[model samples]
Each structure stands twice: as structure tokens, then as C-alpha cells.
Target: MTVVLLLCIITSQLTVVLSSAGNFWTYKGSLGADHWHLDYPHCGGIRQSPIDLQTRDVVVDQTYLSPLVFSGYDRVSNLFFRLENNGHTVQVGLNDKTMMISGGGLGATFVAEQFHFHWGAVDERGSEHSVNGRHFPMEMHIVHFNKKYGNFSSSVGKVDGLAVLGFFFEIGRFNEHFQEIIDHFGEIQFKNQHININSIPMIDLMPARLTNYYRYHGSLTTPPCFESVTWTIFNETIEIAEEQLVEFRTTIFENDKSDGGVFMDISDDYRPVQCMFRRRLYASHPSLKYDMASPRENGNDGVSNQPTRLLFSMFLVCIWCILPFFSF
Candidate 1:
């Protein structure tokens, strides 16, 4: 009788441990990304995303990576969107089916599905995919599915099923376009909270230039970690005010208010850079100089001319000094 009771107690404890390990996941604590493989097998697989983009190692492929064509992104007057705090990250569901993208080495047209963000607790550590070992303040992913697959749901596991456009964010002057989305933060202060937004042009949220980017075949950054994404990480970054970043870090909670649990802020919700085993990162433009920290002027090469300007300034100073000595 004593042996049977002990055996039953051991069995119950084992069941509880397995249940907790399998169900939930988070960015930190025991259920963090490090332990995710216990529940999700693909999280530990090769071709995982959010790898550091070492620019020097990238292959320039102008022939295959032509400029991408955007369609229906500017249409906004009659469109509707759903913005929600989904316990993990803040996501915006794209309601318009007309918005689509093609080219830039993607063989098939992909219809836009939804967009979401990954951020850190502070301004310096938010972005998921880093450039030359530097993280941006934030990162945005615009997800799409191959038109041939019918919809995002049916396209989950195929090699060419998904195409995700990634853009990084930097601190700068106020962005009026992004302000439209930020204004609704109050309504989604808790998890599962969502609000419908009307008339926001999808084009306004992206950088003006869309030609230069880095492409690679990788899995989704989040779980189930499907190795189906054809990633196009733009070389240009979107700018937002520092105050707006604070609102993202502070305003949203991961748990619902009705749960009567300790409220956790949904910050630092990005996965760490994964290993690149045999994959090659490709650059769209051959001569494009990639820099995540510096600012680029509109309608010019992405490289900064600050060093050239400094050289010219020194030459002028030398000429000025000699002019006084050579006075006639």
C-alpha cells in the first residue's frame, strides 16, 4: 500500500512538469528562447532568423535581385486595420488584399497579410536583426504570403510560402505618419485588447526608398519557427521620436487586467541573433555601403559623404592660412 501511494505521487508530479513546459513561452525566465526547443523542435533547427547581417560577408546579386514593385500600398481611404496587443508583441492585421509585392528575387507575387513589431526596454537594444553587430531602437516586419498558396494559413510550411519585409527604426524628429498608430496605444494597454483603425496608408509606414535590401532564406523569428520565410531586410531605416519609443516600452501590458495577475510590460520582445551555418546573405545593389548607425540623404547613394566633407573643410583651412602669409 505504501509503495503504490509513492508511485502515484511521483507520476502526478511528472505530469505537472511536462504540462507547464509544453504550453507557455516568454522572452525571459525559465520559459525563454533558450528553453524553447523543449516545446518547439524547430526553434533549435538551422535556418532560424534574426541573424546578424555582417555586410562584409554579403554577396551582391544585382541580376537576380531587381528592384521590388509595390502595388496598392498607397490606397487607404476605404481600408480598415486591426491593431492589437497579443500578449507577445503588438500586431496590426492588414485587411486589404490588394496590397502586394513582387520581384527583388521573389519569383512569385506575395499578398500582404499583417505587420508587427519587436522592441527592447530601452532605445539601444530593440531590433531583432542587427547590422555589423549593432541593434536599432526597433524593428518592424511586414508579412506576406505567396499568392499561389491562396492565403497565409495554407502557406505556412512550404519553402516559398512566406515573404517578410523587415525595416529598422532609429531615433529622430517626430514622425506624423507613425503617430496615427501610436495614438491608439491607450486602447490596447492590456493583452488581447484591440481597436479598429480606418484609413492609414501602408506606404506611409515604410521608408521612401525600397530598392536596396539584403535577402536571405530563413525561418520566422518566433515559434513554430517555420523555415519558410524569404526575407528582405531594407537598407533604409524609418525614424521615430524618442518619446514615441518610450510609449511602446511603457504603455502595454502582457497580461489582461481581468486576470488579477502581476502586470508585465511587453518590452525586450526580440529573439537573440541566431547562428548562420551555411546560408548566404545577398545584397540588392552591388556598390551599396550599408550602415545602420548613420543617416542617409534622400535620392542619393546610401553611403554617407561626411568623410569627404571633412577633407574639403581641411583643404579650405590650409588655403586660408597660406593666403594671409602670401598677402601682396
Candidate 2:
């Protein structure tokens, strides 16, 4: 191992790049190293930002409970995103398997509690953090709750009970799976009222690479951007065509209904990058036995690491907005 590598291992702070080529990590953001306040209630002592991962501590964890199932789901109109009345918080219903993450140590379990997103102007990059100084078109956050913490209500005020995973969205081919959310984009409240639909399953809203990603600690990109979350970013990014991007912009209501589109509303939803602050980033690079690691999982295993678990990207933004959701 190299000198820096040994230091990282000794200090227990290391970050490794997945690679120069990947179907994953397309979600990496394009952000500047402007500023981040640790004392700010939004991101203080416990707050952490996106950190790269290296090959050291990664194992297949399948026995642990994962909350990305077809639980009960809710359907609410997104018209609220465009109105000028200071806008309301994103609405949510429920599902069978969705859960949240908790800071409960390395082997702790986290469930899907809620999901949300942050975007920016259609003209600029929308992700909150950048990778090697690169940004994507959009980013998704799949927030989870540590079962030990409590539900959405009990956990919000406290940090000990939650962990959030973020994924970047870039422009590419069309995504048929995302159409479900796109179809419902117009229902959210734009004026005084909109429609609320039935609950949906969590399985349908995720990318194919559920087990592949690089995880770390970070803060909420939105205001009151809490510093409580266990961020897991997938190496792969989902693809969306130009027309779909345009449709997304139009369907999503913005401050100016006549001008800018939905993309405009979410385009600038990103917050600036935060400081590394000397925190260590852990990585699971598999056993280092495989030639090229899986593009969609944190790392792959051969034998002893049976019952391998898949790393899922909480793709609940864009279509869902304040609420957790995926895109079309």
C-alpha cells in the first residue's frame, strides 16, 4: 500500500474512487467549494458531507433488514411546488417497505422513513455536491430512519435516529420506469388545491443497481439542511431524454408559471458543498478479488460473503419533491 493509503487506514478515514468508467455514479454533482457552516443548526457538529470511498471495509450484508419494498404509498398533487404562497412542505402518504437510516454504528439497521430532493435552474447544475468537481443534472435523496430512533414524527427533532442517501441525476437515454411519477407531476397543488392519489409501492421507484454505491455522512441540501444523515451515493446515474427533461420542467410548477419550466424550479434546489472538516469516509470495495467491481453495488463478494446485500439509491426526489420519490 502507498503512504497516504496507510495513513487513511490507520486514521480510519479513507475514500476511494469507483473508477473512471461506470454506469453508476452518474449522479455525482457539480458544485463549488464555496462554504459550509458547522455551527449552523442546519449543519453543526454531527453534520457530514459527501466523501469518496476506497477499497478496505466492505462486506456483503444481506441478513440486515432493508426498507425498499412495496409498502403502502400515497398520491398527492405537486401543484404546490409552483405557487408563490411560500410553498408548502412536500406531501407524503405511505408504503409497505419504505424506511429510513440511523447513525446506530456500523452494523445498525435503517428503514425508509421518507424521501425528498433539491434542484436548480434548468440552465445550471442541480446537485448539492460535486465529484472531482463535476455535477449532474439532478440529485435524489432517499431518507431513512434508524428503527431505534422512531418514525418520521419522532425522528425529525432528533438526529440519532436517521440517515439519508443521495443520488445524482444526469441527462442520457429515456427511462420508462420514471414515467409513473412524471404522469402524476401535474397533480400536486399549483394554486389553492390539487389531487391526492393512492399509495404506491417502493420497489417500482428504484434503479436497477440497488446494491451498488459509495456511502458516507452528509447534511440536507435544502434549508434547515440538517446535518443528520448517512449518505449513500450510487456509482451509476439514470438516463433521461431531452424531451422528458422538458416535460419534467413543464409539469413541475415554478415561481413563474408562464416562463421557466419544472426543471427551473428544481434546477437550483441544490445547496453549496460543505467542508470535509477532517472527517473520515469509509468504503467497502468488496474482497478485492474481482477484476472489475459491479457497477451497481457497493462491492461484490465471491463465496464466504454469502447472502450478499444490494445497496439501493434513495431515488425519491424530482417527481416527489418535498416528499420522497423517483423520476420518469
Candidate number of the best TM-score: 1
| Ten contiguous residues minimizing lDDT sum, candidate 2 | 30-39
TM agreement with the true structure for every prediction: 0.82, 0.57
Q: Give the per-residue lDDT digits (tens) of candidate 2, residues 1-328.
A: 2333444444333223322322111122422121222113343333545442333333333333232332232333232222121232233333333333333232455666555545555735766666645667666666666666656556554655556666777777777755654566666524223344444444455566645555556665543456666666665666776666665455454343444454223335455554454554443334321323334353534222221221112233333464444444
The numbered model that scores best in lDDT is 1
CA lDDT, candidate 1, residue 37: 62
- Model 1 weakest lDDT span, ten residues long: 11-20
Candidate 1: what lDDT? 0.86
Model 1 clashes, total count: 0
